[model samples]
Each structure stands twice: as C-alpha cells, then as structure tokens.
Target: MKFIHIDKENSIAFYQQIMSSIEKAIKEKKLLRNDKLPSVNKICIEHKISRDTVLLAYEKLKKKGVVKSIRAKGYYVRTEDFNFDERYFLLFDELNIFKEDLLNSFLKGLAGKVQVDTFFHHFDPAMFSKLISDNMGNYSKYIILAANVEGVESSIARLPKNDVYIIDQMRNSLKIYSGIYQNFVENIYTAMESVLDLLQKYNRYILIFPGHKEPYDMVTGFEKFCREHGKNYSVIPDLKNFKLRKGQVFLIPNDRQLVETIEKCNHHHLVIGEDIGIISYNETPLKKVVQNGITTLSTDFSEMGKKLAQMVLKNERKLIENKCTLNLRKSL
Candidate 1:
C-alpha cells in the first residue's frame, strides 16, 4: 500500500523524486494498472513533502499517459509501461518528404524514455492555435515548425517560454525563445553565390515562388543575390502565366512548380542543365537523380534533428542555426 519513497538528500527536485518513486514502483510490479496512487495529503504527511510536489508528479504522470485522475476519486495508474523520462510535442507546418527526414532524424537521435507526438498545421493558423491550446501543458517541450503562420506570437506566449522551441522558419515575435531554425535569407544568397559559375551560361534568373506557405525571406535573398551580381532576374508567382525560355535558369521552391518547369522545358524542346537550368529548394535522395539531378539549397535536416535532441537532453537555452548546405547536381 505504501509504495512511494522519498529521498530528500538527493540533488533531484522533489517533484522529480516523487515521479521517479512512482516509476520505480511501476517497474517493480508494486503498482499495477488502475491501482490508486497515494493521496496528495497522505504523501505529504507521511513523506514530509509538500502537496504541490505530490501534485506536480501526479500531473506529469497524467500527461505522460501513465496515470489518470478521476473527479473526487483521485489518481490511479493508467498503464503498466512506466518508461517516461521526457515527453516532446512536435508541431510542423506540414509533413512532406523533406520534413519527414527532419522528424525521423529527430526521433532516431533520441534515446531512453522519450515520447514524441507529431502534428501538422498545414499552414492554417486556426489549426496551429488549436493544437497548441489542446496540448498546452501535456508535454515537457514544444518543438514547432511555425511556417509563415501569422499572429502565432500570442499563442506561443501562453506556453512556458523556455520550453518552447521554434524550428524551420523563425519569427520575430518568438525570437526570445530558444530554437533551431534555418537562415532562409542568408542560405539562399550564399547557395546561389556558390553556383555562380553554373549560372554564367544563363541569361536570366527566375524564382518560382508561389508565396503562400513559402518564406518571403527567400525572395529577399534571391533579389539581393541578383542585384549584387547584376544578373537579370525575376520572381513569378506561378508558371501558369509565365513562359520558360532557353538560356533561362529557374529557381523553384516547391516540387510542383519544379515539375511544371521541366514540362515547359520539354514543350520548348530545350535540354535540361544545358539549354535551361533548374535549382530547387530542399534536398532529398530522389533530388540527386531527378531531372538528371536537381541542384538544391537546403539545411541539413538530419543534423538539425540531432542537434535538437541534444538541446532537449541537455536542457540548453541557446538558439541554434541548423547548418545549411548547397548540394550541386547536373540540373544546374
């Protein structure tokens, strides 16, 4: 009946000690599913611990899906699996091939008692807020890929600032929070400059930016790169109205437009990487072979994931820029 133990001399926090004791009880078969845990008052009086400490531990277990609290009945063990060191709630704009890499890498990099629940907002601000509101206090950390979503600062402000992390695209409002983000403006500028030699054969540079979910900083970077190099350049909202010509290089952000660009090139009877060049944003394994290789400007998603794991594991409070790289291929 008396399963919980307290060690006040230990350096661990009181709440954490209470959680560890419960986990130890579960692991040793002393606690079973549906078994009622010691009451907060009983725990406090017997162990000389504060009521808040007992409640905090119970709440953490409840959030981890290990314990459930009933109205007037008190807390009971919800499951037999007691491995719950940390829980992370990861939010993304959308799940695509590249983002899949980021997610898988983050998951693979983490070891031990960790649970990651992933969700996507699909660029809907309402869905974004709803997800945050729903999972507000359920996780130890909140990792969000807050795309071009506007007015998220107010929503994120409700969360514990130290526990929230901004990923992918960072916003000015959430700059105070620690994050691992892509430097879109500088990455695009430098990546383009890196392929300047490949660009010399082309007469015009065009960026296919649909401008919906895509970051506007990309446009600024491309514009800056073109102006400094004195290269004739333009940004098109879509390929529906624009005509692709030979001796023109197109920088496409999304794969949909990239495919359209290639199709248009075929209609014009222009050869790729020769008569017309193509550069796409984000790198994937298929990109290496697609269109005889599509030149890509991208950040290392795998490394980003690994670094995020480290940040959480160490409880780091620094904003880190995930390394960006340009993968050169024949399409350019």
Candidate 2:
C-alpha cells in the first residue's frame, strides 16, 4: 500500500479523496495489481483517522474493481487482465436477494470463454460515467442493474449503440436503446393483488418495508395499489417500527426480512411473497425459506444473461431495448 495524505477540507468527502488518490495511483502504476493495501488499522493510524475512513476508501476501490478484499486479509490492488475477449458486463447497485436472483438466472447456461464483470453501486451520474468509461469497452455487452442516477439514461444515450441493456433498476431516465427493464408498476400491482386475496382469507394490516430510498418498482406498485384499493399500508424503513393491525396485510420486501419481522409480529400468520402472488422481486435463497413456498416475482436472469451474451457476441444491438418479465410464484 502506498502512503498518502487524504484531504479533509475539500468539498469532496475524505473517503472520496482517498478513493481518488488510490485510483490515480493505480492508473499511474503507483499501485501494482495484486499489491496488498494497507490494513484498515494501519491506514487509520497513518492517516490519524477513524476506521470508517479506511472502510469507505476500500469500499470505493472494491466497487471499481481496483481493489479486492481477501478473507481474513486486507484489501489488495486488483491487477488488470491483459487479454480481452467478448463479454457481458453486469453492473448492479447493491448485493441483495434481488441481485442474487438476477446473477443466478443470468449465469444460467453460460458456456464458453467469456468474461463477466459485475459492479454494484447506487452511484451518482459522474461516478457512473467514470465507471462506464473505465469498464464499458472491456465487455462486448453492458447488462446494467439500473440504480438511481440523476440523468443516467441521457448519459447512456451517448454510449455506442447497442452496448447497454438494463435490468431491474433503471439508473437514468427511460429513453435509451433496447434493454431489459422491470415493469415496476405492474409487478407491484400483481404482488399486491395477491396480498389482498390472502388478506381476504386472513385479515391483517399490510406494512411495506423498503430497503432503501431509491425508487423501487415493487414499492411504487404496492403503494399505488394500496391507494387504489383503499387498503391500509405504510412504507416503513425498519421493521421494528411496524404496527401490526389485526387482519391487516403487510407487503414486506423480501422473505428474510418478512420472516424476521413476522417472527417478531407475535407469531402472526405471515405469507411469503414469491413469484406468483405477493412475490418478492429479486428471487434467491429466500425461495426455500418460505416453507409455504414463497410467492415471488422472479427475473429471467439466465435468459437475460444468455441473450446479453448473444447480443455482444453477435453484435445484435437492437435487442438491448428489451424489457424483462416477472416470474410469478405462490406466496399470496
């Protein structure tokens, strides 16, 4: 790890400064690939800062593929690959159940020598632009899990035609080329209708747990449906605050949280949302957790992955404009 001074006075954050410096160092060959970074404790002592600072810097580098963390070891500078081949780039906002399902599905049936790069972030436009510039050309096709960006679509519009396809979350405005996008509105409505049906059987107040602040298709859809149906629903961030109403339905985001929450809900008879009714948006291990079988809105990740690979390999850009489908399950 290279020794350095992280600026704290600049409008840019201290962690961001650390990241910028590290990135520059990597670009200038100051930090060689596979070079182990300074340990969190060491960096904190050297910089006379907190562990959070080091963690933030490490996180940024990890996200950019500039650095990686070894289990039980510290962060290390990532070496760039010399050989280039046709690949499908998978960019995501975060790692969670939704992302897991997408990756599992997309990785399905992928055979051959091809590189897959998966980046996760809820990045600003500038950060995303940098990421695109840094990584886009390396892969033949860009499979983006759109996060919240101020003007992501417009920025993507400037990229080479047929290079980018989106899934689940859309980072920018909707106006770019053919790519996979989730029908958030419709999917949520479907999930909610299923919830309502189950609620009719066993009355309960529905409390919606949103993981983050970014706009979510399922959450929006749930909210809209609740409004239209006059069903009681509240969008709460934390489950501890949820007020359970007798016979009221709660539309929690994923099975884990739902399970955790329901367990705490005085053993309320909760329904797991899988693909069919009250389905969870991003499918993964939670599918098995819902003993009653999770009703989920599963993504065709494998199909999308294969299609994206074909687009890149065959130079079929028009297919980038495709929208994704929801795989329904039976929670509701």
Candidate 3:
C-alpha cells in the first residue's frame, strides 16, 4: 500500500497520522477487503521511524476493528462489518455544569484504552441496573463517577467484579482505595462556613438551590457554622414574594432560575453553597456557565482523569469515593 504525509510536524503523533491515512484509504476502497498491511519492520524502515511506533499504530487500528492481526501472519484490513458502541456510563446531575466537566475529564482520561460505549442516562438507578444487566458481560471495563452513592448504590452493587472507580464522590472512608477526588460532609461544612463568613457581615442571606439534597448539606454546614459563631438565621424558600430588608446575604444554589434571579437583583448581594460550590466542579474543556464570575468549592478534575488512567491501566476495579475542593470564585 502507498503512504502519504500531510503535515509531518503536526501536533498529533506520526503513528496516529499514519493510522488515519490507512483507515481513510480503507474507507475509500484504496485498500480493498482483506488487504495485507505493510509489515511492521518494512513500515518502520520506509517511514524512518521506530518499529514500536508502527506496532502501536497497528494495535490501535486493530482495536478499532479497522484491521486485525492473524496468528502466524501479519495484520490485514478487517473485511467483515465493524460494529461497536463508543460511549461510557456517566452519571451526574443534568443541571450541574461542573458535573458534566467531571464526567468529561474521566472520559477523556480513558481516550486510547477503551472507547466510552454510552453514557449512563441521567441519575437513574434502574437505568444503571439495566445497563449492568444487559452489557456487563459485553463490557470489559466500567468507570463510574458517582456524585451520590446512596442514590444508586443498590443498583450498582450487583454488577460483576469489573474495573470500577468513583471519581468525585466516595462510598465510605474506612477502606483504602484509589480515586481522582473525594467528597464528604466536611467539604459541605466548609462551603457553608465560607458563605456564612460573608453573610455574618451582612446579617441576612438569601439561599437558592435546585433541590433539597445539596441545600440540605449546605444548611447543615452553614447552621453549624452560624451556631458556633453566635449568629441566628432563617431560611426563606419564597425568594420572589420575599423582600430582603437590610444586612441580609442570599445563598442560592447553582440553578438557571436562581442565576436569573441574581442577575435581576439591583443592590442585593448573593452567595452560593460554600461546600460543593458550583465553580469547583467544572472538570472539562466545555464551559458550563458564562457568568460575571462565581466562587465555588471544587476538585481538580484532571487529577481525577489521571487517576482514571491509572485505574484502567492497573485494572483497578473497586468502588472508590472521593471529593472536591472548595474552589472560590467571584459569582457571589
């Protein structure tokens, strides 16, 4: 087969470039069905590159079903239909941008090793159970970045012993395991304390949230901080009908409605959860929100990606739980 060079100094690896060229050739019928690939040594000698490079490229092409290696024979273009899913099981709050980044980081971390077959649909215990039931035997590895263990614990508990690692959230702290990050009540408390430290100066705080779980954690942390600091507070769920009198700070959860409400406020100051802050959770290249600026308590999602890479390489398959950092930004 003939090979062509597009851009030798391109950012992508030369082997990857070669692989792309050959795959494209196959698609275009340049390399007919069952065509034999250039021998690894020959390709290396012709390309003036290392044998490992050519072998690595061929291995990757084999994994994608673009080519296959035959026993006692060289690799050949796959003649049969190549069918496989390319998505992974990603579970997180749909409304949370940070959660999306965290999942992306985990998926990107696994780029070459295994393709993400499909993302597990929004946090549904039954859906995860169904996936495990249907594809457990088919899938060689399963990576889950569970934000809430209690939500889907029972469902995931039944899967076969495959490589499993929790990214942003943890199950419990008693056991030693590997993870990209950790989540706990302490971080929640820290987040609340952060907002309260600001609220104490103002006296009244407005709290907005999409649901009760995260808010509940923040409230526990905030109230605990307030009680220790000799301050009294009240929660006003009705923000529209409610009017801030004086010296009151508003702590809203990361929600679009709450975001719009904060935007409309003229002089009123706003604060989000101190723990599990929205800013701390954006772990992907995709930006979740375009805000003036927002403070958050988040974890290093790339580290989570690194940990995932380690787990997949080491074949680490255990339920891991981790948390995020209290990343502070200026959205408040």
Candidate 4:
C-alpha cells in the first residue's frame, strides 16, 4: 500500500526504492509466506508511478525467489529468506583474539552476501565429528578448521564433498577437498631462519611446546632449523620447573606458555631483550605493545580470511597457503 511515498527529491531510483522496502519488510517479518502485495495496477494508480516501474521491482523480487505472481491472483510473498543469498557453517578449532581478527575480516570480505554461523571444536575429534554430522544439511557451505583432531577425514566424508572447505590446518587424509591453510612446518622453519641473526645473540634456543594443541610439524621445523644451522636448541614439553638462564631465547608456541615465560623472567629478575629473549607464535595487537614489543612469527590471518571468502564466492578449489611473516621487536 506504500512505496513509502516515492521521494522524487531522493537520489535512489523509484523501482529500487520499492525493492528495498519489500526486502526490508520481509526481513522485519512484516511480510511472510503467501502475504499479498499491492497489485501492480493499484501501486501505479495510488503512488502515481509508472506500471513499468512497479513491474520492474516485482520481476526482480520474483527472480530472487522473494515474491511470485499468478495469472489473476496478483503478487504475493514467495519467501522471506531475503537476508542472505547463502548460509555458511564456520567451524574453528577455538575462539581466540587472532581468530576473531580472521572472522571479522572474513565477514567484512563477504559483504553480507551470506549469513555465517560459527562454532568451535576445541581440537576435540569427537566434538568435531559430532558438530559436522549434526549440521550435515543445515548450511549451504561448511568451512572447517581441522586443527590436529583425529578421524576428521571420516567425519567430513559424510558431508557434501563439494560444499566443504578446510581452514587453518590441513592434513594428508583430508587433502581431497579445497581450502585455505597454514603450512606450520615451513612457516616455523622459515620464520626462525629469518631471525637467525637475532637468534645468534643468544647462547641457546628453546621451544616451549606442550604436546597437546600444538602441531608436531612445528617441532619438526624448529628442530630442522636448529640442527641444520648447528645452533644449540631444545624442545621441551613445558616451562614447568624450568630454569631461566641468561643468553637464552625461548620460542613459545602457545600464548599461555608465552605468558608463563614472561612471568618466569619477572620472577627471576631477568630483563627481557637483555638477559633473556622471547619469540612467540601468532601476532596480536597486544604483542606489539607488551614488553615494548614481542617479536612474533605469524601468518597474515586477515589476508587468509579475505582470500578464503574469495575462494568460497568464486568456488576456487586450489589449496592455498597463507603468507607468514616475522615481526621483529624488543622481545627478541
């Protein structure tokens, strides 16, 4: 009954205004399935607008499956699913500040073309399988962060193979599908190599790796780099009961341990960047401000998000490895 009085003074095209109003109404639930719309002729007369203008709007809506018309029954709401063209199921290993950056960048890149429902598997294989199995047909597409979980290959096999894309971690068993992934082995190796000069300043290099949650490839890479360079290095499970010594640089893979290392430095009265050095994995905003700055070996997560969005929209099937970078600062 209203095009909301088509304002000739406004810059928006009259037909588009009508389309927006209808779409807005559908989103707000003001119009639902089978709700009748004003007849084309009635809109033409009541709004003193051209029949062609009203027809253009209705035809567009019809094409999008938002509205339909019968030979004599006039137009009616076909569906109220106008908010998005598609729905996405996003599964992450866990929600962290860096992961939040990736999610935000992804949503921005998507530009509202689809609705996203995010979930976390927390690196639990059973939970990962259950979530995917339970939401088998709920979403149009599934983007998963496989983490280091086991049996993911079998779990994802039940899904529509073509509609799934792997995110973050990539495994040999799950290589059949497409995705954006991080090459942790090469990333860690190259990242440390990039800072070889800075590392030489310390007498020994140690990586604080707690077997759980961290990829084994990271240890492999760290060991490879250290061994090949003939540098003194050790990979220990954790910093528990560990001694803080001068001329030592700790390569911390997890944030919690990174904090613990820093606390150890404080407890032992060791001055970071002077008596002790630290290099942590993954970049966060606080890393730049904490301890003057924390040297980080990380992948460009925002770029990964943007590229993943493009991959989904374009249906690109290539295995993409996000670029990694080393942020050198006072912490190292």
lDDT of 1 by residue, 24-67 (tens): 88888999999998889998999887888889899888778678
Tens-place lDDT per residue, model 3, 1-332, is 47534356789998888887887787677887788888888877777888888887877676465676776799788644444422234444343555555556666776655555545545555665665555443344555555442455555555443534445555454123444545445665666566654544455544554453342455555566556766655555545666645455545544454455544453454333321123222333322344435555556655666666667667765544445555445443
Q: Supply the TM-score for candidate 1.
A: 0.83
Q: What lDDT does model 3 reach?
A: 0.55
Model 2 TM-score?
0.59
Q: Which candidate would rank higher by TM-score, 2 or 4?
A: 4
Q: Point to the candidate with the largest lDDT.
A: 1
Judged by whole-model lDDT over C-alpha atoms, candidate 1 comes out at: 0.86
Better of 1 and 2 by TM-score: 1
For all candidates, the clash counts are: 0, 38, 37, 0
Candidates in order, TM-scores: namely 0.83, 0.59, 0.56, 0.74
Q: Per-residue alpha-carbon lDDT of model 2 for 1-332, expressed as tens digits?
A: 46566766678777877877776776777778898777889878877889997797776555445676777987787755423234556777777655565577566535545557777656556767767766643445677765655566655665566666666554335535556555666766765566454545434345455555345655677778878887656666666656554444455555566566546543654333321124444566656455555545555655665565555556555533334344444555
What would you estimate as the lDDT of candidate 2?
Answer: 0.60
Q: Which ten residues in a row have the lowest lDDT in candidate 1?
A: 78-87
The best-first sequence of candidates by TM-score reads 1, 4, 2, 3
On residues 1-332, what C-alpha lDDT tens digit does candidate 4 reach at each position?
A: 44344777889999988888888877878778999998888888878899999998887676455776776888888777766666788999998877888899999999988778899999888899889876665566899988887778888999888889998888778878999888888998898888778788898989888978887778888889889999898889888777989999988989999898888899999989988999899988899999899999898888989999999988787888899888999987
Candidate 3 versus the native: TM-score? Answer: 0.56
Error of 2 at 218 (Å): 2.2
Better of 1 and 2 by lDDT: 1
Candidate 3: regions farther than 4 A off: 1-100, 146-151, 171-184, 191-199, 212-216, 234-240, 267-292, 317-332
Shift in Å, residue 69, candidate 1: 7.3
